[model samples]
Target: MSTTPLPLSALAAPIERGTAAYRRANFALFLAGCSTFSLLYCVQPLLPEFARDFGLAPAVSSLALSLTTAALALAIFIAGALSQQVSRRRLMFASMALAAACNLLAAIAPDWTSLLLARTIEGAMLGGVPAVAMAYLAEEMDPRHLSGAMGLYVAGTAFGGMMGRVGMGVLVEIGSWRSAMAAIGAFGLIAAIGFAALLPPSRRFAPRRGFVARHHLDAWRAHLAHPGLLRLFAIGFVLTSVFVALFNYVGFRLAGAPYDLGPAGISLIFLAYVFGMFSSPFGGRLADRFGGRAPLIGGIAIMTAGAVVTLAAWLPLIVLGICLITIGFFVAHSVASAWVGRLARADKGHASSLYLLFYYFGSSVTGVIGGWAWQHGGWSGEVALTASLALAGIVLAIRIEDPRQPDRSDA
Candidate 1:
């Protein structure tokens, strides 16, 4: 494939369903989502490995991911603004490339502190991906088919998240966590190059060309002031908080108590994300027909039930619970993220950024809170925390006004 970007004339018009541009754009984003999320989350299954090797406390070990998410949350806010002045495709590609290199550095780090630093930087690098990606889909894809296109992107993330955890588990089993990290990093670098070549240059996005502090601050203020957007932002926050919190501590439960599973065994558990991979696109299709309200609430309801089901002592029930969580989370996410594009009248990048700002902030915060819940209250306590947040997500989703213009995020 030629490295030269697609000319503006090629993609100036909105990408319609079944068109070559639509297929190319979606596939490129699929790669982008796969690389970005796999790099971000590959360490999730490695939490145990960190504890065993570093002789750290459970909460302390979680800082590997929590700190990265924390940095990512803040960086997302900055990157949203930065995207205004840069090429969305180039920014995303660079972010992916640098982040992959950072992981390689992390793979060789000699101490816990060094690893944490590398991960944090990796998080910062990833900030460019999500918000920009959402903006890109919202801009380039035909408005009539936004739901389906966004669904494909979310499905990519689902697959990436799955492989990140699942692949890390398998890799660490065959070699070591260090080698696993290096391998995923190398894959991300390749994906970055591919993404840079495949993603059509922006036609809808009018670059601002400089740091217009006043404009950015105003955009943030406007998004914050919009009641509907705030509801979606809250929904984004609750979604990740509950999801990350549960997955964060579940490893300890599987490692100890009733089930004593090794990295490979526990990794098989993350195969649940396959459910997520399917649910996301289905959810998007649902949104296109029904509207955002039904699916958003429905997804959250499923998540709440899944959290409760995990309380069961049976092994099958626990795996079923994880699958339900994965399904519900992706559905809710696909709906909510697409809805963000619908509701934004302008400055789409800023709007997407604000939404993800809340999304990742929740992930970072809950990782620690979930740790405390696990340490003090065990799996039941973790369930209590997730279930409550999920319930709140339902309430917020209910309050959000589904925009009729662009379409619903309802599947």
Candidate 2:
């Protein structure tokens, strides 16, 4: 069932953004991105519904997602290692298809525990895509144009996240959360088929055909010891913690108070990801021209300001603040993600996996902790925690110097 890879020299040219090869690569990966994220986060808007139907606390309901992310974080480590023995394209397609099926199972589960179990397994199945995507791009694309491709891939994730949140919000108006989950699972199935059909075979990769733990361990150790890579990993943890925590509790905040937004109205808030779609590429371009440090710091600053602004009472102002935070998160993430490939001298798959491990770990930990803050201190408490995380990210960004660039600080 395996096709022999062509010589590396023949396929090593990085796909430029406008060429036909680039078009095919981006379209397939974009769909893959959309499917992966939509399935993963589709449960977010349904947290309140779970609380009402299952009589779970906010912190308990948060487990539905936290379990998925926590499992995904650990699974990514294993998946990244497994990918060395499996074809990248096959691994991603299988991941998407399996995760979609898991979503459908969750939709039909009769009890709360069953649904959580489904989500946890879904998270583990979904790990193959993100763990290997950046590595695929790092190996396949022209190194000079890598930022643009990564930006586009990230943009797809934003769109997928928006669809998951907004679509669930809108779909629930017609049916229950179960129906929403079923519908999104169907969409994921379709995207998975398209991804398998459109993606070209890997020319640069040769499957290792078996497990090799020592190699992965060495790479992980080397990356952890490198100061620049270490800082980037820390930044991933901090920024994602802030982003997920804000969105996790914001649903509860908007649903309860003077705003009293319904699910659909709360769903509209995720439309802020539209800003994220644009900011991802824009951040990547900035990184290409200037450096990762400036955009990274600027994004952290914007995220912090947005958190502070959300403390305001006005709904319009709060929405604006969310949009700013969304934009900042995507911008910072785009830079940091692409930087991983550039920074890793070798074992790019292991490097990319480590970055996402921290990223999702942040989501799982802060996401639940923020719910606790909500239970104890309300919106103000959530804002305080997010703001602090953002500030820490900024400080880390300031202190770390990019090895690829000179010591000068100009952005």
Candidate 3:
């Protein structure tokens, strides 16, 4: 066996911490992460407003966000394939700009149908961000800095998701929902501009000259063939299904109950996301100290307990439940997402895309179905659905053969 080491000149030098380029890259990704999520979910807290204004059922009103996520789930595959040919910064910049424009269009949408159409388009446009961002990081960042960068990026998404719902509620309370949408749309546009200006062009990425269907398909096939990857994908599906479904209906429940809440007051509940932001890093630590499985299952248990807590008639208990759910969701997602990267020795981009496909698919499908549960059976029905999904997540985590095999890459 040859004992000779390769020269540094032969390797691609990676972006490391404490550099101008590193700072710009992380901040750019933070903006991209924040803008994509905030715009995608800004409609969440306003489902009641849509129902009242449009004379639609809760299930129908939820299509504003649900349709967008569904379209995003489908478009992720296409975006993953497209990344081969497009420059990372340009593709992400275009996506951010287009999505912001679509959000503005939704703001001025004349009717429910028009709003849904605009939102779906916005979702499809956002396809360029999440998975692509992950792939870009894997390609550009030094391995030592990758974990820290990933955590910060995920934190941005958490912060944005919280602000989007809370800000929507506060804005709608001050003005109309349309004006609120416009304000958020403008925020997204600003973020896009900042992202494009700040992000360094990819130094390590090689742009494929043309698309190759067979090569990409084979990569995806290999990821799906792995048992651990499949389980993580299922966990992604359940984690989001339980979290988004419950949040989707909580606004409806609060809007019409013994404790009626206006948009602003209800938005305060979303501040629970602050707890989620903290929990994500903490979850990674726990996974490091004890392998991924313990924390993964424990997080789901927290979620299950949280779901059951909401069954109480007291408003404080319901809010507490929501907070627990948020914390658990981030914890589980942090572990599971990091695990996906470790599991895929090759085609990491395709693995990221497949995982997110299930993740947002859950958001789109169960987000609306939870509304059905809310309409037919009320809060208890929603709890029932979420609890079942949490249980499924537990079972999936149990079946994973070796969660401890994951490396230092913790999201």
| Per-model lDDT | 0.87, 0.86, 0.83
Candidate 2 error regions (>4 Å):
1-11, 48-61, 372-381, 403-411
Q: Rank the candidates by lDDT, best first.
A: 1, 2, 3
lDDT of 2 at 290: 76
Report lDDT (Cα) of residue 152, candidate 1.
Answer: 86
Q: lDDT of candidate 2?
A: 0.86
- lDDT per residue (tens digit) for residues 59-163 in model 3: 799889878887888888888878867788999999999999999999999999999999999999999999888777766776545545665576678988987
- List the candidate 1 regions with Cα displacement exceeding 4 Å: 1-11, 47-61, 110-113, 405-411
The list of candidate 3 runs beyond 4 A from truth reads 1-11, 16-22, 46-61, 110-114, 142-147, 255-257, 285-291, 368-381, 401-411
Best by TM-score: 1
Task: Give the per-residue lDDT digits (tens) of candidate 2, residues 4-52.
Answer: 3355576556566568877788888889888988999899889989999
Please give the clash total of every predicted structure, in order: 3, 2, 0
lDDT of 2 at 166: 88
Worst 10 residues of 1 by lDDT: 1-10
* The candidate that achieves the highest lDDT relative to the unseen native structure: 1
TM-score ranking of the models: 1, 2, 3
TM-score of each: 0.91, 0.90, 0.85
